[model samples]
Target: MLEVYIDGATLGENGKSAASFVAKNKQVCLEGYTFIGEKTNHEAEFHALYFALVTLKHDYSDEILSIRSDSKIVVDTIEKAYTKNPAFLSYYNKIAELITHFPHVFIKWISDKDNKRADTLARTGLQTESTVIQSCS
Candidate 1:
């Protein structure tokens, strides 16, 4: 099984929003974060989930995957199979599409204390000097 942790953060303004993910297995660990122009904290959280799904889908297509996030909206929206907010519909749809490509995917809600690594990476992503998005894994 492959395990992934994701989180997002916003600094002061629209430009500071960022998303991050850490994916790991017994053999290797891959983690990264990227600046996401202007977006709300919820949108940034979705972006983090999106990045992790996209990054792992190709390589773990046939494996069971588990993803953890500190955002309740992101986790509950997926786990409950509904979203009342129109602003989140697009992200919900994209996540649904991505899940189809994998054999199995689980989205779980986790405490902030348990998600420190992704949170730190997301904050670090905001400190980048470049306006252009940057990512490292």
Candidate 2:
């Protein structure tokens, strides 16, 4: 089984942004990243999931996939408990489309304290354009 946790950060409009994914198996960890430029925080959040899903596409399947995010909008929207504004429907759809490729997935909301690794990577991405967040194993 593979357990993956993802997080994203946005510095400001037109500012640096990044998404980080940490995949853990027992004592091992694998991380991934992408530098997102000039996007909102919400966009960054969704991008984090997108990057993780794409990176794991080759290895993801019926196995349990768990995701954690600080964005209530993304979490609630994905759970179908709330309807997002029509203006952002495209964003929602993009995430939904990516989800179709996963057999079993779980998303949860975690406070900033529990999501430090991702936060660090996000901040790091904002500070350096050439730096790529490393995947920990």
Candidate 3:
């Protein structure tokens, strides 16, 4: 089974957002963090999960997966496979589609303390955005 930890960071509501994930098992370890432009925190959270699933599905399609995130809103929405909010429903729908490629996916809600690595990576994405801007000037 592959254990995936994910996190999303936003500078402010409807502000710059970052998404990150770490996926690992005995055979492999993979991770990614990126600035995803302007989005809400919840949107960023979903993006991280979706980004991770897309990254894993091709290579680890046969493996059972555990998706871990610190956002209750994101985790709850995914677990139910439904959301009343039109904004969130879009993300849930996209994530649900990607899920069909896997054998099984278990989503877990974790504490921010436990998801430090992914959180750090997500914040780094904010710094990366800052760095890119500084270098361009």
- RMSD for each model, in Å, please? 2.8, 2.5, 5.3
Per-residue alpha-carbon lDDT of candidate 3 for residues 42-115, written as tens digits (9 for 90 to 100): 99999899888887888889999999999999989988878999888878988999999999999999998899
What tens-digit string does per-residue lDDT give for candidate 2 at 16-120?
678777777775477766787877787778777778777777665545678888777777877883465774476667767777777877888888888888777
Q: How much is 65 displaced in model 1, in angstroms?
A: 1.2
Provide the clashing-pair count of each candidate structure.
0, 3, 0
Provide the clash count, candidate 2.
3
Best-to-worst order by TM-score is 3, 1, 2
Write model 1 residue lDDT over 27-137, tens digit each, in one string. Answer: 657787888878889999998988878877777678677999999999999999789999889998998999999888898999999999899888887887222223334
TM-score of each: 0.89, 0.82, 0.91
**True-vs-predicted CA distance for residue 25, candidate 2, Å:** 2.5
Give the C-alpha miss distance for residue 107 in model 1, angstroms.
Answer: 1.3
TM accuracy, model 1: 0.89
Runs with alpha carbons beyond 4 Å of true place in candidate 3: 130-137
